[model samples]
Target chain A: MRIAVDLLGGDDAPAVVVDGALRAVRADPDLNLLLVGPSEAADAVIAALDPVDRARITVRPVRDAVRMSDHPSAAREASTVRDAVAAVRDGTADAMVSAGSTGATVTAAALGLGRWPTIRNPALVATLPAVGGPVVLLDVGGSLEPRAGILARHAVLGAAYAAVAHAIDAPRVGLLSVGTEAGKGDRARRTADPVLAAEPLPCNARYVGLVEGYDVSSGARADVVVTDGFTGNVLLKAVEGAYAMAGGPPAGGGVPRAAALLGVSGTVVVCHGAAVAADVASGIALAAHLWRHRATDQMAALLAGHAWKGHDHIIDTEVTTP
Target chain B: MRIAVDLLGGDDAPAVVVDGALRAVRADPDLNLLLVGPSEAADAVIAALDPVDRARITVRPVRDAVRMSDHPSAAREASTVRDAVAAVRDGTADAMVSAGSTGATVTAAALGLGRWPTIRNPALVATLPAVGGPVVLLDVGGSLEPRAGILARHAVLGAAYAAVAHAIDAPRVGLLSVGTEAGKGDRARRTADPVLAAEPLPCNARYVGLVEGYDVSSGARADVVVTDGFTGNVLLKAVEGAYAMAGGPPAGGGVPRAAALLGVSGTVVVCHGAAVAADVASGIALAAHLWRHRATDQMAALLAGHAWKGHDHIIDTEVTTP
Candidate 1:
């Protein structure tokens, strides 16, 4: 399987991205790369590779790619990121990776790969390696509102993602709130609590009502934690910050730099804009892993199976707007 | 100054309450207590204390109080918390402490003491020890919206409270959001960010623009961080959880249990629902500190000074809803 890399993304541009690409290529012998960027960036990777290994690499040289400061729409269609998506859209590559602006990567993917049925907002799924395996959190930086309907959609997405990607049999879904009590949260939460209860979840997932901030780290209440992007982003960082305050993360666990962008059709990964070389390398590995497992396709199929009957509006509009 | 404490508050009621009360009395030699609950509870406290120290303690027998399982409105006209408020209302006590329920304490204080003119929702202000000094966070569990006008008013309330309570000279206020960048937040935050920027802060405070959750722990950006109650409550707990995960807090810092209820006409302190003996004692100490320093009165007087200008509606509505 071939994976495309956006060389012009992230704070540390082509140099770190180039270094990360070299690392990822060496780590996974089965990995074939489509270095999508300017000539110098693609040449940098080629020069560092042995002749035998260089044969496994392909270059799709574009003059430019989506810069972190560029508008998502202004990213040239022929740039590495957009062209990388086109490669997947044309089935030339199995998956793609980017460390660009989250908004831009998301925009390119949602526009190029298309979205699942009834999925208006695309979710940024981050898997935390908790004590109970991987706990999948949705809308990590997507959909930043607490409308019951939005949360309910995320519930289905999280459940399907868990079943397909992590191979969890039955996921327990929990809505993040201040307390576990029925009426424990603010007005939006009070309104969403019952709505989340009534909504149907995929993969035989159970709704555990309300859970607190601790659950994110411990993963005690639910395998699937659903929240709006606003809360999720703040919460994810806060947890990372807490880990920092605690000196570091719990043993065998730490904040993830790479997040899988689900809902858009192809296998795609978005690394943090502040990511380092190791982070970008891990992101590439994650994309390759997802592609190997056919995680995106399987998850998409799972969601299709549990797709809501009449709420096709979500699917038709925007899938990964977060 | 004398303080009245609800004897039947919190999940671990009566016992924890009794233990906490005993600890508080022992810690503060100048403290006088009015234990408002059952006569048996009051007698139990009286029994625990030495006869000599018991001279400083008093009891007011009242059976009614809001239970965690009960509706908050139960603390309306008749209850132990109401009586405690009444004690302060009638000059029987200088201040009060409760760990029973936030809604109940807020309601009791608002009705018993009456809201300060122009303040609709009274804010719960928690002071976190940051690297810089003390950072005051308001609306920990009060309001949960992103109204620009409310946030503006909260800036004023936070500024005065920081000065009067924390003794900070020129408090810097900030709007809590996902990112520090100008437009790095949700819709509500986007609207409130500029509003907070344009509003005039009291006590010589200034707006430092948008800040992240790190600012809350580090206290590097602003002295007063304001947000809706929902975000604050979750953020506070997340910080507490982080401290726990980290082994302990920063050398001399930990999560705060005592929060001062501002925007009301009387002096009130609310402890965490899971208050331990030290939490209760610290809460009582906070009450004493506020009263001894006349912090509440000074805050009120400052409001009175700015009553006609800034925001007359907020003056009567909420101390700050930002």
Candidate 2:
């Protein structure tokens, strides 16, 4: 599968992105990278590859790029992430991977590749290896507000992603809150709890009452954890900080530095802003894996078959303008 | 100062609480405990101590303890926590400590001691040891909804607590968000960011723009980290879980399991519901430390002298009922 790489996305920019592209091509023989940046950066990857493997790489070679400090509105301009999104939209690449500003990437993806049917906001889904299995967490930073409709939609998206991407059967979905007891949490959670319970989920997923922060890493209580982008983003980073404080991560692995952008028509993966070469490589691999499994298409199909008839009004009313 | 101890407060109450009380009395020669629970539980602590040291222990036997599963409103009944709060209200005890339901303790304290001037919701402030110094996090579970005015109040409360309790000079206060950039969070955070920046802080504290989850564990950015109780509660637990996932905590220390209730008229500390003997002992120590320092009274005096006159109307309208 061909994956578009945003060479100007990360803090280190061309250097780390080039190194990551080389690694991604080597890791998978069939992997092809459409390097979307300056010619000098694309040449760095091409010069590193063997003669026979060089053909697996392609260069879009766009000069103008978005800087980390640029406003998110820069994504609308001609930039590396926008070019990468265009590659996927035009079917030149199977998926796209970027380590740029999350706001820019989300804006580019949602605008370039139209959002799926009932989703006004795209949710960023991250999978962490838990004690029992992989736990799917959604809306890590895509939609900050946790309205009942947004949370209900995230439940369905997370469940479908878990089933299609991770092959989990009958995934147990949970709303992340302060306590497991009923009627716990802030105003948004109190309003969202009942809505999630009634919302129809794909893959035979059932809504578990409520789960706490530990459930995100332990995976003992739920397979798919749904939360507002704000809480999920903060929780993910806090877990990373704690691991750093404890010296390193546990045996399973470190906290994921990449997340999949769900609800967009195309496959998009966002790497952490401070990601290094290895993190970018892993993000590209994740994109290729999703593309190989056709996770987005399959999940979308599952969602299409089980649409929430009365929930459209809820989404329109509850989802605030960003 | 004599402190009231709720013997039936934790998951393994009476046993853990008795052991904790015994340890507290032994650790502080001047410490005295007014144990509020069944006579049998108080006797265990007295029996464990020497006859001479036993005089430091007093019992206020009240059998009906608030169970962890009971509704927070149950604090209105004649439960152990209610009796403990009454002991403080009637001037029989200088302070109170409980490891029971946080909601119950907060409710009882707010109702019995009365809230500070211009404060509607009390905040749970927790101090965590960081590389530079101690990082103070507020609203751990007190006020979940993040109103701009409430957040502004918490910023003041956290800054004053850090100065009065920890003696941090010119503490740097930060509003917690997904990123350090301005306008990078949910609606509440976006709205509160400007308010916190403009709000006057006590103890010569200065407002830092914004901080991420890592700042909570690492004091490199800010000394006082402020957020809604929902994010703070989940982030604290998630950090604890990450530390557990790793071998253990860093050399400095683990995440704090005890938090002090701010904005109330009396000195109170709330321990985790599943606190152990050592945790309970440490919580008692925290309460005594606060009482000895006269932290609450000093903070109240500071607020009274520099009240946010125009902000009271904002709090009334913005503070949503749970």
Estimate the TM-score of every prediction. 0.92, 0.96
Residue-level lDDT of model 2, residues B1-322, one tens digit each, is: 8999999999999899999888889999999999999999999999999999988999999999888888888999999999999999999999999999998998899899998878888889998877777999988998888888888988999999999999999999999999888878888889889888888899999999789988887789999999989989888888887777777778988888889998889999999998998888889999999999999899999988865733853457433222
The lDDT of each candidate is: 0.81, 0.88
Q: Name the candidate that leads on lDDT.
A: 2
Could you tell me the lDDT of residue B298 within candidate 1? 94
- Per-residue lDDT, model 1, residue A302, is 77
| CAPRI classification of candidate 1 | acceptable
Over 4 Å off in model 2, which ranges? Answer: A317-322, B317-322
TM-score of 1: 0.92
TM-score of chain A of 1: 0.93
Q: Which digits, one per residue and each the tens of the lDDT, describe model 1 over residues B1-322?
A: 7999999888887888888889889888999999899999888888999999998889999987788767667778588889999999998899999988888888888889998876788888999877678889977887766566667778889999999888899899998877677877787788778777777777899999988777887788999998878778888876776666556677756888889999787889998888887888889889999999998899988987763333633444333221
For candidate 2, give the lDDT of residue A209.
Answer: 78
Chain B TM-score of all predictions, in order? 0.95, 0.97
